[model samples]
Target chain A: MKIEDKKRVLREMVLHRRFEERCYQAYIERKIGGFLHLYPGQEACCNGVMEAARPGHDYVITGYRDHVHAIKCGADPKEVMAELYGKETGSSKGRGGSMHIFDVAHRFMGGYALVGGPFPLAAGMAKAIQLKGGDEIAICFLGDAANNQGTFHETMNMAALWKLPVLFVCENNLYGIGTAIDRSTAVVHQHKRVAAYNIPADECDGQDIEVVYEHARKAVDHVRSGKGPYFLELLTYRYRGHSMSDSRGYRSREEEEMWKQRDPIFILRDRLIAAGEMTMADYEALEKETDAYIENEVIRFAEESPEPRVEDLEKYVLAERETQLPWLTGKAA
Target chain B: MAQIMYWEAIQRAHDEEMARDPLVICMGEDIGVAGGTYKATKGLYEKYGPLRVMDTPISENGFTGLAVGASFLGVRPIVEIMSVNFAWLAMDQMFNSAAKVRYMSGGQLAAPCVFRSAGGAAHQLGAQHSARMEKVFMGIAGLRVVTPSNPKQAYGLLKSAVRCDDPVFINEHELMYNMKGEVPDGEYFHPLEGSEIARSGTDVTLFGYNISVHWCLKAAEILDKQYGISAEVVDLYSLSPLDRDGIRKSVSKTHRAVIAEEDEAPVGVGSEVIAIINEECFFELDAAPVRVHSALVPQPYNHTLEKAAIPDHEDVVKAVLKMFGKA
Candidate 1:
């Protein structure tokens, strides 16, 4: 990877990490409500894959551990935070909370809440792109557990058979809720599972942003070249519990500490400092700046953003209910 | 104009829509080469080819989600389930994703998708297949539920559903598919979310939809000929955006009402109709509205038992007579 690209990936990943960490604090303080799925430990997977694709051209869809992906995909932080705060000025006008962040203009279809649901959607989006004579690819981000889902096979078959432009990136964090990948599936190597569909597959170190970005770029290039769908299994771990309410009795404290030792953000920061590209003071200054940025967004999201009006609930249900049709003249008996 | 069966009209609508628009496509099990279990999508694959007409594995949830996503990206997808019984597999996508996408997205997205399935009792198909679950969909906010009784209405409503920017649930009666009716040639669009008064009268009002509409019409004809009672019949083609005003208008003139439904009596479409009438036209009604519906029991597998379970022409006439105190 180029030096500039590496630096940019590191910066974005750091920003995402700090943003989520601060979100956790705000969540506890009762500022940001609803289900908050922290993506702190999985920052590399998001930044790495996002950096590989061309924004505003290629589409990205993922599961609910999504704030990082939204930020990395170029959604304004303030608007995303505002959405988390359930403000009318939010991205989905506060109708969609943390789980359903969508920006059509930016090509981020959404962060769907249902597990394994986004796979088929990504396949369909790829089909649409192919039908429209576009080379743009769709990157589907899912967890390790999603690989065992029936939709995974169904969508992979469709994508391969149709040769749709889609890259399936599974962030293998080992555990889905409480069930570890080994206990959940017979085949632990999720990348090899795509082999049944005859799609080429690869694996990457999701903890290393540069490694993930390089592999993602190659896989995306293959899909864009009309080589059909490709699967990339990113080996990673999450430092936090699955959700705010999870006690995480399934995994040990030692296991969590071990994963934290290889934290993507800290590792990347150390790499930059060791290479003399960035100093300790420079890293401190960057963290302070990100903290200020998050603080301002929280204040704006809480104070200035309006709650959605009660009447607005009924507005978007139907496209045009008022346009009368000729055959609608009374009831038939 | 041409006379065709209701199922044939549905197939024609899908064929015409696929031919007219490149984005319009069909996806479902047995819909490709088998041409749908009931032949509703017959000859679609031959004309549109495999790319437009897709044969999916029996993963209703997956394909339904695929259709929803495709709709979000500007494709008008017509998803067929072999039977409405199988639709329960995809209801999560239907209720959560497809129906709620437009509202949840706050108008940023619209799910212009149609889910068509054969519903209601047909012979001895048994309890599993004999579900008049259109009422369940009617309760959902964003979905437009339509049940067309004849070929003309089927074609027009289906064409409108394919073109509409909302998720439409079209319930077709398996038994009524072969019944022929007149359908106009060339481009035509029927209005969804509206009702149609099939037979106009002055004495009493009869409300029915889908298969029951035919029975109600037959009953009205019988009452007009055998007795002096001229009963008006109203077909609630669309259930969600129900034409309450139209029902009220008919009830005001007739002063008496009878609601006929193919489903079980309690909490059925009849209950909703009765509630609406009581709320809207209480003063206009001469007697409390009568509900003629299927018995509250699992649909029996025996042909005779099944026939007795669902409402028929005789049942409709009996209900009207009872309402008039002439039984």
Candidate 2:
């Protein structure tokens, strides 16, 4: 990566962390509501993989911990924040709240709420690409626990069978809500399980963004070059509880502190600063700029945005098939 | 017009649509090389080749979700669940994902995929297989549920469903595949909403859909000849919207109604029709509308018991006669 790209990526990691922290603050301030899943420690997984591929051309989907992924995929930070606030200007027009942020223009397919539900969808997108004879590949970012979903096994087999262009990036945060990988999954190592489907797999330390970016390049090449689906498991940890409701009583404090010591943001930022690629003043300046932008621009847009109008409550039910809701229309009953 | 079997109509629709747009594809177990179990997708695998005519494994949820996901990117995939019974495994994809994608994504995305499944009891397929799942699909909000009574309807509805820019669940009947009717020689797109007045009448309305539409027609024949009762057969093809205006118009004209369905009364097609009648045309009703539904039990395997378990033309006739106080 070029020096400029390295510095930019380091700044993106910091921006992602600050954006999520602002979301946590907004949740407490009653500015945002509904189920919010924040990605604090797993920044490298989304950034590293996405950086290796074209953001607006390629497809990206994940399971609910989506704010950062959408932003990284070129979704407007204001629009994402407005979606969390359930505003009319939100990404989903305030229909999906936080779990369903979508930017079709950016090719961020969506963030589905169901665990492992995106498995087949990713394969399907790849199949479409193959049908159209396009070079774009579909990438699905899901937690390690999502691998246990039946779609996981079924999709892997089909992707391999058809040689569909898709990359399965699993962020192994060690737990599915409260259940540990050992208790929930048979094979603790997620990449090894892909052997059953003959898919080439790799594992890397997710906290290290540079390592993630390096391995992800190979994975992206393998899938985009028509070698079929590739699985990349990034071993990372979450800083906060699973959701706002999670007290996180199930995990140990010592383990949390241990993982935090290897924080992905700090790792990338410190490395860039020590290499003379970025000065301490530059790092502090970038952090302050990102903080101000999130506070003044993203949050302010969300706070000042209007609520979705009531007339649109029944819209989007069908594309153009039924212009009106059957019941609501004067012609129906 | 060309006389064709119901399955042939479905096949022709697939061929026409696939030829019309290269984006349209078919996926299901046993649909490619072995042909579909009902032959609804026969010979297309050789014509369209592997990618377009995909024969998937026995993972209903996987392929169904996969097809819906493909629809997001402008690939129109028609997924055939071998049986509606097997579709139970894939309802999450159908109801939660395909149905809700457009609305949840705030119109930025659309899932224009069509899911076809053969349902209803046919020659004692056993309790598990003998499912009338139209009610389940109809209850969903984002999906458009349509059932075809004959070859003409099967062809037109499937074609229209493919062109439709929304998720549509075509609930086909296993018994109707071999049944024949005249289909138009030219391209035809059936309306996805409203009921079809299968037969015109004045004294009573026989409301039904899919297989039940045939029973209503048969019963209407018996009522016209034997009982001299002019019973109108209203084909409630659009189950999701329930054709409220068409249903009310028929019921108001007839002054009485008899809803015939293969499903049991509770929370099924019969119950929904009755609710619409009561809410829309209660004053037009001269007497209480009666429902002719199957016995409230899991369909039996034995031929004799199965015959007793399901509602047929005779039940529809009885329902009409009783409604007119001539039974």
Candidate 3:
């Protein structure tokens, strides 16, 4: 990879790491309410894959653990933070809250709450792109657990049959809430599951940004070149629990420590330094800058953003005025 | 005026919409080459080509989700679920993603698509195939549920549903495919919500939708001819928004109501109609509102048992006669 590109990737990874750490702190302080899923350990997977995909052209969708993916795909951090705050200024105008963040202009489809829900949506988007006559592809991010959902198989078959431009990216964090991959998934190798449909799939180390980026480039190129749906699996882990409510007694402290030692952000940082592309002071300065941005700018923006009004709660339910709500009008229109 | 079958009306509507808009596309299990199970999409593939009329695998959730996702990017996908019985598999995509995408996204996105399925019992199709899940769909907030009772509405409402900027669940009956009614030539858009008085009367109002509307109309004739009771028939086509004013006006004039539905009792369409009458026209009502619904049991495979399951002309007449103390 180019030195400048490497620095840029490292910078984005640092930003995502610092931003999510602050999000964790804010959640503890009760500033960010509802279910909070931090993306500290899996920053490299998001940054690498999203960086490889074109922002305006390619579409990105994922499950609820999607703070970093939105940011990486050009969604403003302030708007995203405001969304987490349930403010009107948020990306989804407070309607989606933390789980549903969408920026149509940025081509970030959304963060669906249901497992395996985004796959069909992504395939549909890919189909739409094909119908509309475009080489653009849709990238869907699924957790290790979601690979077992019926929608995963259904969507994969449709994407392959119709030759839709979609890349099904599975971040295998080894656990689906409390269930491990071995316990939940019949096929432990998530990428191998897609082989049943004759689609090409690859797996890479999610801890290494360079490796993930390399695999993502080939995968994105294949889909963008109209090679049907591609499945790329990143063997990763999550440092935080499933949500704020999860006690996380399912895994041990030693397992957490082992994964923490292979943190993607630090892995990239050490690689850049060893190659003389970046120094330790440079990494620290970048990290400090990102921390300052989130602590001061992002947090302040979310804090100042106004919550959506009670009156406008019914807005966006329907596109136009086809049917009337009984509560809103006292009678149907 | 041109008389056409229910399937012909639906096919014409698809033809007109697909010709007018290039963005409009259709997809389902047998919609392309096989021309749909009910032939609702007959000749669409040959006319618009395979790209516009897509034949999808037997994956309801998959294709349904794909349609919703495609709608996100401005391609209006008219998805078919073959039968409402199969719609259960795609309910997650329908409710979670398609129905809630617009509201949950805070207007950042909208799924202006249509999902049409041939539903309800016909020819003793048995328990699994006999599905009138309109009550369940009507309960969902973001979806627009419409059931057409005649060819005119099958044409007009579908044209309107295609033009609608929200997700529309069109409940087309399996038995109604061959039924014919008068449809005016040229383009017309019907109202997606509100009830239409199929027949006017002053004594009692008999409300029904889809196949039940025909029963109500026949019962109205029987009441007027056999008995001296003047019965009105109101077609509650739009189940979700439900023409509250139309219903109120009809019930207030008649002062009596008998809601006929093919669906089973308890929290179904008839129960909703009863609730509306109880709330809006309780004072106007002289007799207690009666619900002529199907037997509260799984539809049987036996022909005689299946015939006894859902409400018919006799059930509607008996309910109306009892309401007027004529039985």
Candidate 4:
């Protein structure tokens, strides 16, 4: 990667880290409600892959640990936070909370609550792109645990058979809630599971941003080139528990500490510093700037955003035919 | 107007819709090469080719979700579940993803697709194959459930379902595939809401849908010829967003009602119809609304036992006669 691209990637990973850290505090403070799944430790996995995606042409869909994915895909931070706060100014107009953030204009399809929901959806979007005569591809991000779902095998078979232009990404965080990957799934290597369908797959160290970018670029090229769906497994870990209320008694503190030492954000920052591109002062400045932005801009905007009224609760239950405002609105910020 | 078989009428709607819009596609098991088990998708694969008329793997959950997903981008996918019994495997996709994606996404997305499946009992298929699951779909919020009685409705309602901006489940009777009727010519679209009075009379009203509509029509003939009872029959085409006012109009005129359904008694269409009558036309009714539904047990495999389980024309007559204290 170029020096300029490296700096941008490092900054985005740091910003995502800072944003998720504050969200953790906000959830504790009872400001952000509902099921909160943080993506603090998996920034490189999203930023690396999403940066390679075509901004308006390519589509992105993921599981619910999705704050960074939406932000990385160009959704406004203010609107995203507002959605988590259940505010009217949110992306989904306060109708979809944390688990469902969607912006069609940006082509960030959604953050599905169900574990394996996005597989078939990604295939569908790819079909639409194929029928429309576009090389635009769909990237569906799922967890290692979701690999056990019947949707995984089913979608992979259809995607391979139909040769849908989709990149099936598995963010292997080693654990599905409390159950470990080896305990839940018979196949530990998720990419190999897709071999039954004859789809090409690759695995990478998600803790390293450069490695993630390199592997993701190759996979994206394969799908965009209409070589069928490519499954890429990004082996990473989460710093926090699965949700806001998780005790995380299943995993040890040592295992958590082990993953945190090689955090993606730290890896990118150290690489830039060692390359004499950025100093310790520059790194501190970036962290301070990101923290200030989250506190003053993102959180302030969400706190100030208005809560949707009860009277309009039924507004988006079905799309309106005339304007299609809220549902089929082509312009999504 | 061409008189065609019920399945042929459905096939014509599929053919016409596929011709009308390039976005319209069909996906199911054996639908492409084998011409569908029920022949509802006959000649479509040859007409539209493989890309448009897709033959999916036996994985109902996967293909159903894929079709629902395709609809998000404005691709009108008409997914056919070979049997409604097989649809049980896809209900998670049907209920959670397809039905609720629009509302759950706060209308930022909509699944404008049709899930066409042939349900209702067909001789000794046993409890598993013979499932009348329209009641299962009717209870769901975002779905439009429609059951067709004859050829015209099977054609018109299906065309309308494809065009509608909501997910629709067209529950066709497996036994009624050979039944023939006249389908009107040139651009016909039936509304996905409201009930049609199949026959008009004054003494009593007989309510039915799908196969049960034929039973009510037959029972009406028997009631008029044998007992001198003027019986009106209402075909409940749209099961959900039910025609409450249309039902009220018929029940108020007749002052009596008999709801005939192939499904069991509890929490079925019959219950909902009776509830509507009690709420809307209580004062107009001369006698309590009677429901002529199948036995509450699973459909038996034996021919004699199976015939006794399902409600026929005689059951409708017996219920009506009992209401009049003449049984």
Instruction: List where candidate 2 sits over 4 angstroms from the true fold.
Output: A321-333
True contacts kept of each: 0.48, 0.68, 0.72, 0.48
DockQ of each: 0.50, 0.53, 0.53, 0.42
Task: Give the docking tier of candidate 4.
Answer: acceptable
Q: Lowest lDDT 10-mer window, candidate 4 chain A? A: A324-333
TM-score of each: 0.95, 0.98, 0.97, 0.96
**Model 4 clash pairs?**
A327-B107
lDDT of 4: 0.88
| Number of the candidate with higher TM-score, 1 or 4 | 4
**DockQ of candidate 1 (2 decimals):** 0.50
TM-score of chain B of each: 0.98, 0.99, 0.98, 0.99
Q: By summed lDDT, which 10 consecutive residues of candidate 3 chain A come out lowest?
A: A324-333
Error of 2 at B202 (Å): 0.9
Q: After superposition, how far is residue A85 of candidate 2 from its true place, in Å?
A: 0.3
What is the lDDT of every predicted structure here?
0.85, 0.91, 0.88, 0.88
Best of the two (1, 2) by TM-score: 2
> Per-residue CA lDDT of candidate 1, range B1-327, in tens?
999988889999998888889999999998989888888899999999988899988788878888887887898999998788889888878888888877766577778899998899987888898887887888898888998989998998888888777899998888888899999887677778667889999999999999889888999999999988999999998887788888889999999999888888777788888888988989998898988888888889998888788778898899788878899
DockQ of candidate 2 relative to the true structure:
0.53
- Sorting all predicted structures by TM-score, with the top scorer first, yields 2, 3, 4, 1
* Tens-digit lDDT track of model 3 for A91-187: 9998887888888888888999999899999999998899888878899998989988899889888888888999999999999998888988788
